[model samples]
Target: MRATLIDDLPDEKLATAVADLVRPGGRWRKVDRGYTQAQQWIVRWPDGRSVFVKSGTDALTWGWLEAEIGVYAAVDAPWMPRLVASAGDGQGCGPVLVLEDLHEAQWPDPWEDTMVAAVVATLEEVHARTAPAGLPPLSDRRDVLHGWPLVARDPRPFLSTGLAGARWLERALPVLEAASARADLSGDALLHLDLRSDNICRHRGQVKLVDWTWACRGNPVFDTCAWLPSLHAEGGPRPERIAPGQPEFAAMLAGYFCSQAGLPPQQPGSQRRAVQRAQAAAALPWAARELGLPDPGDAPREGVPR
Candidate 1:
């Protein structure tokens, strides 16, 4: 679980380990975006072939990286990144996951309506595919839903910023909890818990989903519903248009993000808290709109919160 960067390893050893998977003489260039838990790089082979590499030495990230390898190995969908190679023990040096480099792929910009529809369709296709049973269950997120009850007892994190009045937030907690409890988070289909724009790409006229660390067996609709807050915050259509008639599911997700947003920062240079806060802010209004409650106003634009 020690923090180990690619530079910490001998060049020859690293090359030898990856040689079987990619062209032997490829160069590694760090990819500086959307990688929080691991070191990521795009490896370009001298032959013009390329692959994306994600390596993690910390226990949390290594575990997720390993899970990603399993998910990739288990599924064969066009919308997913093809797995190239992987290395690691369950523990120790951790794991390195290499995947197909999506050539000429571009991240969605301004999130036009057509692009949003494409993303939703792609997600639906992924959910339609049967998921292998051994994957982690959605029940693992139970703590996230149950955490709302505790917020009333300790309101410091939720009140520290004064973004929403403490009194209003307190009054909404019970309603949020009730709606969250009614949500059906269980399902047989695979769910991509993280579906932000950073993890999605468009290439060859198709949408592709990436970052399988949070992949799980859950209500597929939850995946689509959860994406609304981020989509709206990023200039896409409102939540009602993206996912309509799912107020309970939206409420559950709002609680999840709001609870996480309240926590203190977990690491140096980490934007997890800020991102969660933005999502929470964005989600509140959607939930309120669905529940016929007063609007909480616009959330900060999507990205790392300033």
Candidate 2:
């Protein structure tokens, strides 16, 4: 029987394509998302060991998780998933990655203090590694964010017109550009641009970091900054209104600095505040634009905000 192609395949078709890769009798179950861009699956082997398979278009940005395989190949840690096998014909529409399953891992609520410490330590160690040249730098700063393509791939057909949606992308471009100019391009160390807790799992008394596509060489502080707001929220979920200079932000800064080189906490003063405000202003606009919704503020101007 001819194998099914991976391109543009809906869930059913993609499931068929994946079946060809796994052993017979291996049942496949789809994993829901709070994280990532690829379609995830849980495959149970005859021996009962489960593995995960991810599939998506071959776009460099969406295909970033493939980079995680390479990264895991380069780094040494007991906490990260071991890359099993990856197959992709860059020319064909079918690109797939198969990795060791982490179905047994579980993370406690409020995140254990040791777990948090371990995560910070891992980030510090990973960020210290030298990164390959020619790849984009991993920065959470404006420069890093701006350097990425403004248009992300949108599979959906419509756009949102809500206030939270309209002002998001429309107001964000300028802020991103301005932040990029002042961003630190120094110290090309390997960094995980996204370190949200959802990507972390606890297994066998160890913590594992998943999702590696956004990993790059850049300033570590920005990566630290990204984790602060989310990790400190109630139940580790982001809050609707996070006041500046709050204890939550302070704890994140303390965790980051103390976990690594012990630098004093960088207060989220004007500069960081500006970045936050700019980001908040941009979110709604981005959502609207992503859905292809009409923006009332789509006027052309010399110095609108960037």
Candidate 3:
């Protein structure tokens, strides 16, 4: 389904939806940051209660919002925000999720050593929790975990774009593919799949992992590995120091980002390619270091190659 934006909602319908979660006289103030794929607002009711409202209008985003709803209902983790209420019709109308407003919470600064360690420890706790059965398999998301193999088979994207260290990537494709194949990505632990600092926040001395749409059944360690690139890009420790003894996982991630980085820009938000580029550039160094290959010294800076 196509993704919908918050502006797509009619004023009357949006009011009705908000009323379901907050008092009738409540007002919604848009939150300026941390909303990538959805619209977010802080709803302040007349009774002095505040809640967070996240609504997605596009089909793709609607589906993810629905999945998040299900995950929230199923899990009782204190580290996650509380789902207050929700409204949606499975059709194209999209879904709105109302959650407890973590007013004093703050996204951790990846550059801070203490905050980084805290985030890592929180991830380990999340992984330690047993995942409920029947969650979507991480393997099912071919675009995320398995795209590297296809990219390895066809080096056009890496070579054609003149990506930094393209020759190294071409040479290491087989080894990366082998690492991808040998990586043990299966497990009973619930994986966040996407674990950047933006999705994690500290609220009243507890780490809360928000954004459950990407939650899946897979190796929890993959979450840690996935977060390394963002940490590195943000001036934190290198992936090697953050996650030692996991070259295969790093290689697979490198391949995944490398595969997507050279693709044409996606529509609506042309930032997808840029995000992939940054992640790929950040991850390649880790993968190369781990694989004993040449450094791919940050070729693509956060945007489409010119």
Model 1 segments beyond 4 Å from truth? Answer: 1-13, 89-92, 298-306
> What TM-score does candidate 3 get on C-alpha atoms?
0.86
lDDT string for model 2 (1-306, tens) is 011222232355455555555544466676654233466777776787777777774475345755665676676667568776565532243566677888667754567667767777777777676876555654344322443122212201111212222244345434433333444545687776666555777777777777776777776665665564446542432322222323222322322221222112234221333323333333323323333444424533232121
Please say which candidate is ahead in lDDT: 1 or 2: 1
Please write out the lDDT profile of model 1 over residues 110-216, one tens digit for every residue: 68778888998898898897678788888778776655666666766665544465656756778878888888878888888788878888878878888888888
After TM-score superposition, what is the CA distance of residue 162 in candidate 3 from its true location, in Å? 5.5
lDDT of each: 0.74, 0.50, 0.73
- In angstroms, what RMSD does candidate 2 have relative to the true structure? 12.9
Clashing pairs in 3: 2-59, 3-58, 4-57, 4-58
TM-score order of candidates, top first: 1, 3, 2
lDDT, candidate 3, residue 117? Answer: 86
True-vs-predicted CA distance for residue 154, candidate 3, Å: 4.7
Index of the highest-TM-score prediction = 1
